[model samples]
Target chain A: AQTIHQWPVAEIKAVGSPLSLGCTIKGKSSPNLYWYWQATGGTLQQLFYSITVGQVESVVQLNLSASRPKDDQFILSTEKLLLSHSGFYLCAWSPTGVEQYFGPGTRLTVL
Target chain B: QQQVRQSPQSLTVWEGETAILNCSYEDSTFNYFPWYQQFPGEGPALLISIRSVSDKKEDGRFTIFFNKREKKLSLHITDSQPGDSATYFCAASAGGTNTGKLTFGDGTVLTVKP
Candidate 1:
């Protein structure tokens, strides 16, 4: 079975603060990883996706970046938080295109 | 282009009644359509999915109907229950991409009443 884990389930940060959200997947190697943001009552917006280590692609530029430091780890980071960046962040991995498995999302509130 | 669009921002259904959610897409390249169910704080789960080559797919109480030419799809939940209340999202994707990125719909909130 495959399992995905995310850290700091919830966080509150002030504007201009740095932020980092981490995710790790087990039981899968070199799986496709993605970072998505969901605003209040909004759809899931894909921010970034990575297929291999040390390679990442940005789909939407919300002033955030992502890095694939390891085969099973992907991170989303920002040097300065924007008030509009506040939302529920979700990390997902897919072994195949048929379905995607997601971790418990990280709820961030930027004041 | 907002590849996908879901109807009825919210829905209310009586217990044991059927709840239907509609989704349509503008992109013809989309080969996969999936319906995801999400609780208030959790990530969306794959409730059911249908491929472009097939007209329908079913899993237990959940059924997905697909119209390839119309580029429309719907999710029908039989015998709704209070536990089934959640936000349902419609997602579309192409298969050839290695990134496995999905285009998602805004979502519809379903409330099952007893």
Candidate 2:
């Protein structure tokens, strides 16, 4: 079975502060990765997706960026945090880019 | 514009009753549809899915009815249980270069009472 792990289950930061969240998938090699954000009681919005290492595509310009540093790891980061950036961030992996499996998620609170 | 849409932002049903959730999309190229179940804090889980080529798909108590011409689909949950309460999201995706990127609906919150 494959397991996806996300770091810093939760975080609280002030505006203008930098933030970084990480995700790692075990048991899957070179799987496609994606990042998504969901506001409180709101729908999900796809932020970025990476099909291979060092190549990431932005689905929506939320002013955030992502990197696939390794085959099993994907990172989401920002130099400055916006009030609107505070939300539940999810990391997902797809074996065939059709049916995706999501991780536990990271809760970010921008103060 | 939102490519995918779901009706009845919220729903309530009694145990043993059937609960239906509807979804529709505007893009004709979208060939895949998947429904996800999410709790308050956890990530969404892929509950079931259907392809445009098929009119219907079923898995145990869950069924998906697809209409390719109308660009519509629906998820039906039979014998609803209280445990089924959660936010259900309808998602659509197309093949080719944009494959696997899903556009999700706002979602429907379902409550099943015993």
Task: Put down candidate 2 lDDT per residue, B1-114, tens digits, no spaces.
Answer: 889999999999999999999999999989989899999899999999998989999999999999888889999999999999999999988955533688999999999999
Q: Which ten residues in a row have the lowest lDDT in candidate 2 chain B?
A: B92-101
Residue-level lDDT tens digits of model 1 in A1-111:
889999889999999999999999999998989999999778999899888999999999999999999999999999999999999999999886457878899999999
For A1-111, candidate 2 gives per-residue lDDT tens digits of: 999999989999999999999999999998989999999899988899999999899989988989999999999999999999999999999988889889999999999
- Report clash pairs, candidate 1: none
Minimum summed lDDT over a 10-residue window in model 2 chain A is located at A40-49
Residue B14 displacement in candidate 2 (angstroms): 0.4
- lDDT at residue A27 of model 2 (Cα atoms): 99
Error of 2 at A90 (Å): 0.4
**For model 2, what is the alpha-carbon lDDT of residue A15?**
98
Candidate 1 wrongly placed segments (more than 4 Å): none
Q: Give model 1's TM-score for chain A to 2 decimal places.
A: 0.97
What local lDDT score does residue A54 receive in model 2, on the 0 to 100 scale? 92
Model 2 local distance difference test score = 0.93
